[model samples]
Target chain A: MPLSSRPVSRRTTLAAAPLLALAGCRWGPAEDGDEPAAEPSNAVPDEQQVKAALQAIADADAFVKDVSADHVGLAEPLAALTALHTAHQALIAKEGDTGTTVRMGTPTRATAALKAVRRRELGLQRTLTKLAGEVSSGELARTLAAMAAGVAQQVALLPETAKDADA
Target chain B: MTGTDALQTTLAAEHAAVWIYGVLGGQTSQSSQPALYDAVTTAYVTHRSRRDQLVRWVRDADEVPVAAEVAYELPNAARTPAELKAIGLQVEQRCAAAYADLVGRTTEDERAWGVNALVESAVRQLDFDGDPTDLPGIDA
Candidate 1:
């Protein structure tokens, strides 16, 4: 959707009082001698959240790579996840951090490997969701939240196994 | 934008969503398309709840909440199940964008609410056959 379609902006041109009234206590002009606001100590730095998310994606990618290599038959099913992680890396990764070459060991059996992948994906989803809430930047939080939701869509489409039923 | 402005934008989207989903539910048949009917019904209920919640938030902020239009235009006639599903996807995509903007323009509890709304709408798009995208709300 076009940004112009935002209702409040359009309404502001017609009438500004009610919307301005909503600003209330929060809205104000800075005084001439005022100092800049300090960063909240409790807030997670954006760089930290981004780095953590990138590392999680890298780890998940490594695990998927090992599992697919061990079980060639599983490659097709895992390709979707690989694509998702790669796209996410492009969006959130910094220049030097994009190259994550960590290798993870795979389970002996294909079923066990698939189960492990599912668990890891779910864990990564949770990590992203938590990071979304804790990050200092609102835009980054939105991106992280959307990433979590994308993982959720993939989780929903995974083939249901006996172990998955327990999960 | 301020938090209240973001809330109002989201509220406006919810108004359109609630109206659109109601039309979609009416277009679907319970006997012939039970699954679709159920999805549409669920979407309608969810959008209605979100709309009401947005109204409350805006009112609490001491602003007059935007009123819902008397009617909303459907993307198409939506006579077939396929058409209905398409409209459903459109409604959710729009809402997802709105929530994404809300997330960027708010903070604390309000931003958290926007994050949840964005996630829900992204998942809801899957019900209408949307592929799992890398970024659910970002235009890219």
Candidate 2:
């Protein structure tokens, strides 16, 4: 088992069981010898939404890495933010998402880059919050909501200039 | 769990949080540790308001709200400001988890309320020197 495949395998096993359990009222027990019911209509859409959300995270991670690399002074301050994106990717990324690559545009000066990152972080928080409510699975919704809250915490601690940027 | 059950569980956590914050606020000094004092006081007031809101929500659903325990056992003696901050962090972490669970088990207005509470608790954790994480309530 390759290291990269670990999260995909975990998600594959964990996803179906919880949806069935949570939607128990809508899905009755299968009769003896009966074929498994058709896949839930919402499952594909939910996966697509999750993929898009994961892509957004990847983009942010790449941007942060680029900025940190260019501005050595920022490496320490942005370390937690990078770790946050990694943790989120682990939880939300699905099969095929591991190899996904996103193009992060050219970086600006350190101060400008930090402000831009802060804006993007806030934008990502909003995206996660909206997706949380839109998802069909309650469990996934909770995870996304928590992710948004996590972003909120980091956003709150950004440099004082970043705060001014928002205003 | 049912939505009602999630609400009751969160109500119970809020009860404990309110009591614990009260104790933490009392232990923190106003003059020497003004910053810690303000954090504890703010948390105390926020938890109290959240507890009251939970009670109203439970009653609105026609379910009996769970009552707070007469006292909650402190995790530590909390004799110093650092210890008090630790307790404050723990309380916010626990409440964040409860709010996350509530978000899953609810919808519409209740779910919105749960999301707001989870966000507030996550930010509050930083005041107590908590490390920011990828998932606030879930990881906590």
User: Can you write out model 1's per-residue Cα lDDT over B33-121, one digit (the tens) per residue?
Assistant: 99899899999999899899889999999999988889988778999988999988888877877776676666678777877887888
Show the colliding residue pairs in model 1.
none
Per-residue CA lDDT of candidate 2, range B1-140, in tens? Answer: 57777788788888888888888877889999999999999998998998899899999999999888899888799998778889888888888877877777777778878888888999999999998876777666
> Tens digit of lDDT per residue, candidate 1, span A39-64?
36786558888878877887787788
**Which ranges of candidate 1 are over 4 A from the true structure?**
A1-45, A98-105, A161-167
The CA root-mean-square deviation of candidate 2, after full C-alpha superposition on the true structure, stands at 8.6
Worst 10 residues of 1 chain B by lDDT: B131-140
Give the best candidate by DockQ.
2
User: How does the DockQ of candidate 2 come out?
Assistant: 0.21
Best by lDDT: 2
Per-prediction TM-score to the true structure, in the order listed = 0.80, 0.79
Cα lDDT listed for each candidate: 0.73, 0.74
- Per-candidate iRMS values, in order, are 9.5, 8.6
Q: What is the lDDT of residue B106 in candidate 2?
A: 79
